[model samples]
Target: MKKLCSVMAGCAVLAMLPLTAFAYPIDVQKQLNGLSIDYNSYDTDNDIASIQVNNYGSTDAICRVVFNNGPESPRTRTIEVPAGKHKNATAKFTRTIIKMRINLTCTPK
Candidate 1:
């Protein structure tokens, strides 16, 4: 009876482990025109924050990117790159924002 009770307690503890020790990956890709913009969250203690943008298209593209902190204001930058290349850009923010806006323009190969 003692061994059976111990085994049941051990099984209960193992079942709770999955609830606390679980991780989920996020996918942040949206398509526009002929380009697929892939974005991911980044963390930094410095004053500037950088985002990785990948061009998943067949042709060269130019990205008109905008970073907003809230309803207050936003910063913009343009990045020109060929296909299968990744670009990095930094945006200085006074406060954290809810979402980011990424606009792209595809150029002929």
Candidate 2:
């Protein structure tokens, strides 16, 4: 019984390892001009955030991405995506992020 209890405790500790990671919620606001635009947002790290923009329209596109973290100045990035291509925009913040907001705007080129 003593050995069983020790093994159970070890298992519990291992199981809890994955729970130590902090994952925050991400919110996105987008505006696209009659084009098919898809985006994915990620809280890549404690101070880093990224967004992936996918353009599925027949025409190339110019995209503007804005990343906002609480109490931090917003970061802006511009990218050009060809038809059926994808692009990534990333920003790093000075402080750890509790929540992330992304604004995406795309226009045909």
Candidate 3:
């Protein structure tokens, strides 16, 4: 019974490993032309990151999102956000990301 309990505890610890992982930091730089644009950045995975753009203005807008990871090429994603709508942009890097830097530029479409 003691051996079984020890095995169960080990299994529990292994299962909790995924939950112990914390997200990396994300930095966002934005240039919105007087539009009500809001954005949220996320560290999706070890080698992936994403941004969610929310447009609360009355006009449609075009947005460009760039994701940069250390020692890897920057990834750029261009998206259109309709009025009162939102969109998501994601990028995957070749290596595990320690920190993410994002540049966001939006203009009326």
Put down candidate 1 lDDT per residue, 17-73, tens digits, no spaces. Answer: 745322222223334465665655453322334567777776777766565444656
Q: Any runs in candidate 1 off by more than 4 Å, and if so which?
A: 1-31, 95-109
Per-residue lDDT of model 3, residues 1-109, tens digit only: 9999999999999988876485898999999989999998888888999999999999999999989987988999999999999999999988989999999999999
Write one digit per residue (lDDT tens) for candidate 2, span 4-109.
9999999999988875586789999999999999998988888899999999889999999989987989999999999999999999999999999998999999
State candidate 2's TM-score. Answer: 0.88
Best by TM-score: 2
The TM-score measured for candidate 1 stands at 0.52
Error of 1 at 21 (Å): 19
Per-prediction tally of clashes: 0, 0, 0
Q: Ranking by TM-score, best first? A: 2, 3, 1
Error of 1 at 59 (Å): 0.5
- lDDT at 90, model 1: 67
- What C-alpha lDDT, on a 0 to 100 scale, does residue 84 get in candidate 2? 97
